[model samples]
Target: MPGKTKRSGDLATALAALAGLSYLPPVAAAPLTFASPPAEIAKAVLDDEPGTVAVGIWRNQQGRFALQRNPVGSVGEVVEDDSAHAQPLFEIGSISKVFTGLLLAQAVERGDLSLDDTLGKLLEAKATLKPETAAITLRQLVTHSACLPREPQDFPGYGTPNPFSRHDRWKIYAGLSGMTLEHAPPCGAAYSNLGMGLVGQLLSDHYAKPWDVLVRENITGPLGMRDTMQYLGRQASRLATGYQHEALQGPWDFDALSGAGALRSTAPDLLLLARALMAGRAGPLGPAAERALTPLGYFRGDEIGYAILIRGPAGHRTYHHDGLTGGYRTLLAFAPDTQEAVAILASNSHASPVKVLTGITASRYPIAPATQMAPAPAALAEYGGVYQADKDTSFTFVAQDGKLYRRSTGTGFRALSPGGPDTFVDADAGARYVFSREAGEIVRVDYYLGDSGFGGFSSFSGVAGLRTKEAAPPVAVVSLDTQLDYAGHYRARRIIRTDLDLDVRAENGQLGVRAGNWFRRPVFPVAGKPDRFAYENGRSQLQFERDAAGHVAGVVLYENGVIRLRRLP
Candidate 1:
């Protein structure tokens, strides 16, 4: 009788608490003079958003200025009041890849490794890498051209709410042993955490030490980045608690993949590194650091010269990297030509620090805006369709009022103005979209962000990947008895280090799924498909599997890849 109308009391209470509570306002803090360009930018960011604790550092030929506000919160406590020099530890995330990239350059200078060295030569004995993987060079890995998936196949099955917590060295090697290249080496740039993780692992093995040791002895140590490290260790008290939508989130830990996004640092330390890079000082790794800043080639339509992203032409360019973890967001960017740099570290996961960094950079270096024009109605209609890059990522173009709008699950819709035939520009964000046609039919789309559309852009091809807006038939009402039968506990088929269990329950005549204690959401039955259910706000689907006796035995999750979960007795 409770099947169709009952709700979980705990879930209801949690949701209520989440909705009722408001984020704490920024505490009264330091007064920053808006005299300098960086100071003005910092004030604008703080004034625009309340309850945001941010630290920004600007260094130019004139001098250095740092700005801060409020106190950094961790878990539920405010650890330290923010100051221009407050050394509150913040997770650097993917920026760790930039450090690893510098390490590779250092290795090359020491004659310890070469960018041309093959993966087979470095990791042959540790894991049974695919033949194609063996042929991938270190340069390809650092530039994200090794064609590796963003994460390993079993990454989801790891089960921990914090995915990287238990993905240790052995598991990493195991994943590599079974990996099959989806595309050949030097396949147009696809950002890959796996590839960067491999760079750290190979460097550690070659040095006969741990990755943390290698980073400290070479990159951070030489640059005088005392607070930067893979682990907080004794400095845990200085670490800020990360927050997501006002909910407390745990800090991320790394095993083998620590090289991907494992370092915690302070704004001052990042500024120190940036200053050294801009000065091109002669230190132990200084020459190598300069080399790492060189542009390797075009990636996703941007320059990929080393481990970090490079933008603009040769003489005028910005070399930078951005990082995101559960509760932290960071931006480290600098322009070499103007001797200016911006480093922003924030405690809120949803915060967009890059926008602030961009503001600072744009003020220093002006970018020409793209000219906009009204496109014909037929042109707008031709590009209107749903295009998907992967199972979990997609874009939809719609024609409304003679203008083409682009939509995604993450960001809603933004109207695009035509810059040229089959080319559109988003003036506010400085993004450009160019459509490719074959025999007068729209076949592909390319998207470029920043740089006023001077570099390469990521391409999405194939007409078969398009989705239509046509309405579907009404879903048949599933029997209450059948819905009850689907209730059970399920676990991933692959044995993982952490728990990956799915609990299904029939509540209020609908099916609800909870993965461990992290994700709990309702699922709806698909029209004309009795065994399929949609979840994750329709970004993912689950297909129930049956045993020989016609009883539910398991489920297949369809997202970026297929994951099998067996029904547990």
Candidate 2:
């Protein structure tokens, strides 16, 4: 009853705040200035999206400037009214990883932990861990090189919109007990939530305190970030409603993985955090912040520093992190050389605040324009192949007409002009693809699409099986009747308080499936396997099982984990 009451209270508070905002004056744009023009940046970001709310802050030697704009509309509401300021609470998502990284630095500074300390050394007394995981070091976790999967394999309630709501400590430890590394530590940089969460958990165990408490005592409190916290707790009244597209969405909840993306803060608080990072001084944790910004290696189109990503060249480097949860999107970035920092927080998940944030940063410190280059035909041919980020997502590079082009499902081929050696740029989408070579052989490609959703880039390794045109096979179409047989509603085997359902539909003589809001796509029958379906360009597969009567009984969905769902009726 207490939990229910809290949920109701939170909703009431959020709705009440939204209602009160209706009567408030329209948020005015700050006056323009040459150093950091708020009006110009706001026009570029908010002009297209009329009802979006944005809070922007810039700090430099000239001074600090802040702006807030709440367009006239509530998410999913017909009425055109909403309000926000620089101090309202918002979920910072993965930016919380930076705070966790800072905690690791602090621990090392205090002689309580070492960057090279093994997972076995820290958690051996708490629970048994696999040798591979035990061998992973704290540095690897912070740098995202531990080769841990993005999420726990046995993560419960995987199909739910709030995937991490039910992922508590018990589930985390249980998931780790059966865990095995896909690759050894330092196996290139892969963004991982599990690795960062473990860092937070280790810190909690060492201090014998909760993650939030440790953060507040060591980081937020010292930085004067009074409005920042892990849980809204009694401050729910200040929390803003989150929106995905035009629909209202639930806020993310965290348990063991709170360290990954659980912290919530206001724009002012984040600006304070950014200032501390740029100034590289805030007392006890100041030195740790400096250490956290030190570059470890290159990853995802940027230098993989501790928990932060560093971009641009020397003297114009930008240290930053961006985050996305169920319904919130946030970005915090700063150029230390110019002492200019920007924090953009939005309630709308689809908002592209990063563009405006980067625009402002560029105004202060311009990035070099991308130039075109021409590589030898042999060099271009060697990079031609299919690269996959997951089962359902892949990019195929084709050499045609003496030029390199990229093609993918549902999209036409686009020219990939050379930007540099082993690097290509997509002029249309403003994306850059950099190839990684080992012994002069292409091994992986990193795609940088700019800071918009979650992280700005994804690393896709070249698929050896699809290296040649002849190696790939064609897909077979399923019979109409057979496709219809698989159409039904199914329920996830492991359900929490929230009911999880999967919908398998046959449309236009094709079979498609969706689980909650994760993704929806047509599943084609594999070349020779009639019962097996490939989705996301063969990045994932689904298998249908039959009953004694030869009727469809259940479905097995395979991606990062295997999920079994039974027919509802």
Candidate 3:
């Protein structure tokens, strides 16, 4: 029952407090003026596309404009957002990692923790860690090239609706410690949520304090970021309501992984921090700020490069991070060279403030095309239908009330609109997903996030591989007899050997199976396919093998590899 609901009670408390509170009246004064912003910049901000909410520009500590604008709407929609008074205290997610990095840099400055220290050395001799991961260094974690897998093989508490709960954090870490490494650390760059969370743990150990408290004392408290909180708690009133598409959605609180993406702050507070970072002599980070943003390595993209905690794009190098929770999207960007920063927070999960924010740095902000023509309903309808790349991988495009929606097998579809016959716009970010057809049939799907291109997918013609299929209806629907025989922990011995477990139960006409340490998803049987059943962690796949007697015997779990389990009591 607890797992079924995603909304946090803490978030609700925060909202209740915010309900009666009101901001001071706006100054009847003109907009804060220091210098003339580019005319094109103003137009891009004003002509905000659909799915966008708040847009602000701060240049050289002089010109600042806080404009409330809605995507694809009249001035009233913009006015409703109240950009002038829209307190931007939303969870900025991984952007909080940058703050954690600053704390680490400060620690190194004080001779408390060194960047060169390996993870094994940081932990007390009593704390257990896998032998392979002992070589993982703090430096590798910062650069995101630790080659650490993104999550523990058996981690289940991840992606919960109310991810900030105490139940999620302790359960997830306990599960992770029991797991094995997918690759050795420092082998190559692998973006990992687990690796970042471990950094928080290490920092906590080094300071002999809690991770959240350490962050507050070293960074947030010093920067005067009163609104940022790792847990939603009773402070939700100042937080903006998060939305999925257009409807209000539940909140996300990363309690255990606070170092990875747990802090929430307003735009003004973020800009204040950015201004300090640019000044290079602010609070706890004074004189040691340069070490935090130095280039570590290339990012996972083509256009820009990554340096440890810093991301360099084109002419400017910035300390940046963006967050993507279910119904909320947040962005924070600051030019390390110019001391100019822009924070865009959108309540709508479909909203994309990144394009508008990044354009300021690139000098090519997106403007609505002057010539606009609505596509014919019939024309848009033709793009609808399922498209397959392989038997194992397929995408579907369904036409809903004249608008097109796209989805993959295990993922949900978001509404998309037309830009051209071959191109369609992502309703959220205004990015393009282009299609190329062969003999009037789509063959390739290419995605572009602004000017940066995301590679395309092509159909793999007639390759021999296991194809997913729905099993036919069972001839005999009988309850499973082996209940007590199958109850207990089963370790994944081959691939990860993550000491994961499975619990079995017989109820009402069928067998129910629950697996994983933290997050438990229901495992349903494959109809008429003997012991085979569908198991979905993040992605779903068929599992279980039958013995010669047609009884469930060796269990083969497929997730990047085949993990077998011999039944144990």
Instruction: Give per-residue CA lDDT, model 1, range 1-569, as digits (tens).
Output: 00111222222222221111100111112222212345444454333222334454454344344344433342221223224455578887888888888888888877888899998888877888888878899999998888887677676522234667677878888887888887779876667777898889888889899999998988788777898998777899888777543445678888888788899998778877777777663634567867888877665434776788875556777777877666666778877677666676766554555555344333433334546567677756778876654443455676766767664433335566777777776545445666778788877666555434343222321112244453222331255688777889889745565556787876434466766543245566676776898862576898999988999999888867888889988
Worst 10 residues of 3 by lDDT: 19-28
TM-score of 2: 0.65
Q: Candidate 3: misplaced stretches above 4 Å?
A: 1-52, 63-76, 79-88, 157-159, 164-173, 232-234, 281-284, 302-315, 357-361, 364-569
TM-score of model number 3:
0.54
lDDT of 2 by residue, 73-170 (tens): 52221211112233568888888998998888878877889999998888776668888878889999888888887667755432245666777776
In order, what lDDT does every prediction score? Answer: 0.64, 0.63, 0.51
The best candidate by TM-score is 1
Among residues 3 or more apart in sequence or in different chains, the pairs in candidate 1 whose N, CA or C atoms overlap within 3 Å are 4-508, 4-509, 5-508, 73-241, 74-241, 295-305, 296-305, 301-456, 301-457
Deviation in Å, model 1, residue 385 alpha carbon:
2.5
